[model samples]
Target: MTSQIELKSGTAMAPADPVLRDFRNFLFLVWKHLNLPEPTDVQYDLAAYLQKGPKRSVIEAFRGVGKSWVTSAFVCWLLLNNPQLNIMVVSAAKDRADAFSTFTKRLIAEMPILEHLKPGKGQRDSNIAFDVGPAGASQSPSVKSVGITGQLTGSRADVIIADDVESLNNAMTSTMRDLLSERIKEFDAVLKPGGRVIYLGTPQTEMSIYNRLPERGYEIRIWPARIPADPDKYQGRLAPFVMRMIQDGKGPGTPVDPKRFHDLDLLEREASYGRSGFALQFMLDTSLSDQDRYPLKFRDLMVTSLDPRMAPVKLMWASDPDKRLDIPMVGLQGDAYHRPMWMAPEMAEYTGCVMAIDPSGRGKDETAYAIVKHLNGWLYVVASGGFKDGYGEATLKGLALLAKQHGANKIIVEANFGDGMFTQLLKPVVSRIHAVEIEEVKHNQQKERRICDTLEPVMNQHRLVFDQAVIEHDHKGTSEPIRQLMYQMSRITRDRGSLAKDDRLDVLAMAVGYWAESMARDTDKAHEEHLESLRDKAYEDFIELVHRNTNSGYEIDEPSWLN
Candidate 1:
């Protein structure tokens, strides 16, 4: 369609051809001219956005959609409308770049309306580099195809099209991602003034370059298989691709391309891809990746507040009777710890308790500990926190105090860091202060594996309960103490950068493992020892002996200590 309209000066001037001027119209004309299926609503909307021309933009559409075809049409529309505009097409590799150019060149050659805009009569006619018109003395190819790693410096473009630059293999590792990002930066140097930089690809990772480009001033447009109903919650957050979808009047949860994608097809794809893969491929929900990697869930842990007055058993630290001053005895603060499982509403008779420790040598690293109790097969997360004094005097005394307060007879410290010195240094300090026992444990398993293997089963069965007070205190997950410990447990990933340290998490896992293993390790011994204690009590029955010797007060059979 040649555009020629009469001018006001009685001379004829060509108007921007109607078909080439509006991108949507250009798409419709091209689709009609080639005798192809009409573009979907999403396809047309994508073409419209690119036509509007944002300085920098990201087009993340679901795979199999005709986004690339529409983009190819848009390139043709631009060259036809602005004949001299230089364009560079970039992809993950040379072959992919050639494919884009091949399709584009095919479109121009096959369409009758685009015949005049074909490659030069005597100049370059290759798919990689082609001309829009006959070659001139000062002519360079109007379109150039280059891989992201290929030569990008010697040429300049009025528009740089980066199509699918992120590949799965390149995005899996941090180093590869950095290399891709650096390679993509060359477009900036080669772009002419005021030209638009367009990026089109599916995001491969949570930290993919597609997700990070917005920080550098690229406007991103995401088209997922389905658009969420309420999008206000996702204003600034990038992943999940939740946005106010305008193409279809259909509400959220409905397919963006209802005509092409069926309900069963989508569900089958989701099941086939699994959670993480489905999120990355279709739903555009990367948030599910952490849930899949992190074994602990926020929902698995029970939350409850405790009051000291309601405590069934209390331990008090009192001034020695030999002291003359009137210092008052301080009872256990129940609110600090002691969260019984929700299933067991009331506190039960506890058979064993231990405090597990992961000690640090420097104040910068935390020395974390957890006091766990075992009743039957049930375990209680009594209390957990960190001491910043490392393995010094304060750390030793702190563990002793915590053990006494929680009535825990055993304090198990990780021997890996200090080479068994953690418990050795605490032995004299705890013996001099209280009768609490300190034990050393040499960890032979990976820290992450240790935590997941021990804690996953117990948590899944709802046998572990955590203190709600501590969670509330660190609601934002900021501190590196026990409060932050729970946060780490809920987000500990196999990926390196996700969690740099797991000291507190290690202590918590060790504590849970202590009681979990005790059910197997000490079941028989514990039962025999418990029965032996009862037998020992029978011989020292002061009340029965006292009653029998009521008539002979001085000859009572009561133990000398009691007397």
Candidate 2:
């Protein structure tokens, strides 16, 4: 077939044969044949990266960038250049992979320049697997499609195109994300020597698998819909071409591809997908987005050393320059623990102490506990930890000893699991160790919402405080960061199961909720009530002195001046 393209304007032009060798030229010819508009600047840049990028690379572009279409055309260019090379397309689902292959096959069949590479007789011709006409006999087809979880043992490929393999459904929980990570490892075994693997997708969460691929020696390049104001968030991961544009004075909110997504269009999309969603999907930013989505802030809680028996009568919270703690923080960006700015000189005994337990059986879950003390109008977290031993004797006795050591007046156990069996088992242990009152509490509302509702307000008011030792203990006690209390507090959202393991945060929420009524009392009103009680006691003592004198043998006499 001649490398000539006929334009819609009823004219024919034949370019040099070497022009077709460039993937960008090939893409232009394909677009003309499909009667689509001319390729945008960003699309041309994408084509350039596909041709000259590293062997193992990732392409993270915003939605509606037409990345898949450009890639499909590039696949045709690859076969036109070398028909013997085998390629594989993988996705989270089988149908998506098939669609990619189908589009590539259609391009080869319909385009005149690619007519020589069309599948011939006695060759695999289906969409799932197909071979080019000029390819020699081989064990693998010229192009094949499969899901990430499908059979990938015996196949081999020179190029692997992973198209949106990390979807929201497959990467919701830690276990599911782990399984997906393991499953994708099959690509290494299926890859031939000196092969290339390309990943194309947006991140689903802050812990996205795409973010971890860089540690394995894969070079990543990201292109957002607009130039980012905070380029530091990308950590120099932005495409060199994009960085150049930014250096050339392209301000933030300026559309990277004005032909496709203009300012008005992007604004509409931003409104459609809230700020967080737009940040994740369009901007490819996870950290700043999560800071907006998650309600709890680590800096809101006052961190200080506290005596279990007594606490300051009044404390003030501030986020001024000197109030920020220098401790390690795992919360979102710009979030850090803060110490109180001021504290009263007077100290008083705690009103009550309560222990809350989030019970769990065996397996990956843990039975978490927290001890909280209530004062005038504030709550203090003193102790918290998790027991992986489940309902075993060690776990029960450990919990009993913790309550006894903390001088807890009541123990509240979450009865969601095992139908109150954990509470019953704990009763015998507590009877022997501390003899504290145990109460079973059942919850019908969603766990994430409940925890956030119970904690966000108190944290916002700076009424919740954490002992410095508790923060240190929580950080060092667990090998898995997800099980840590501070981790749970900083990462939870209102969405159900937003946290993989929330037992630690759940118990903390329950303990804080125990003093909800007391927290409702205004600080000034409580002080006034205390003073009124002191005055009533003084009046009663004066009356008692006069009555005692009247009952005595000697009668009470008036002052000499009065006589």
Leading candidate by TM-score: 2
Q: RMSD in angstroms, candidate 1?
A: 11.5
For model 1, residues 1-563, the per-residue Cα lDDT tens digits are 21332113222222265535667766876677667777777777788788884889998887777787888998888877776878899999889888988888898787665766777667578999988873343344678899888999887788988999888766654456768889988888998899989988887645578878988899877777876555542344332323445443657677877777777788888888886787778766555554455566544544445432232222212223332222211111111222232232333367677889888887667788887777545566667777778888888888888788777778888888867877788889888777876778887766666778888877766556555655554444344332366556764555543444577778888888877765453333444555566556775676777777886765654567543
The prediction achieving the highest lDDT against the true structure is 2
Give the residue spans of candidate 2 off by over 4 A: 1-21, 173-175, 267-280, 285-289, 320-322, 326-328, 362-364, 523-563
Model 1, runs deviating above 4 Å: 1-19, 25-40, 52-59, 66-222, 225-280, 285-293, 307-352, 361-365, 374-378, 387-407, 425-435, 475-483, 493-498, 517-563
Q: What's the CA error at residue 119 for candidate 2, in Å? A: 3.0
TM-score of each candidate structure, all chains considered together? 0.57, 0.85
Question: How well does candidate 1 score on lDDT at residue 448?
Answer: 68
What 10-residue stretch in candidate 1 is worst by lDDT? Answer: 326-335
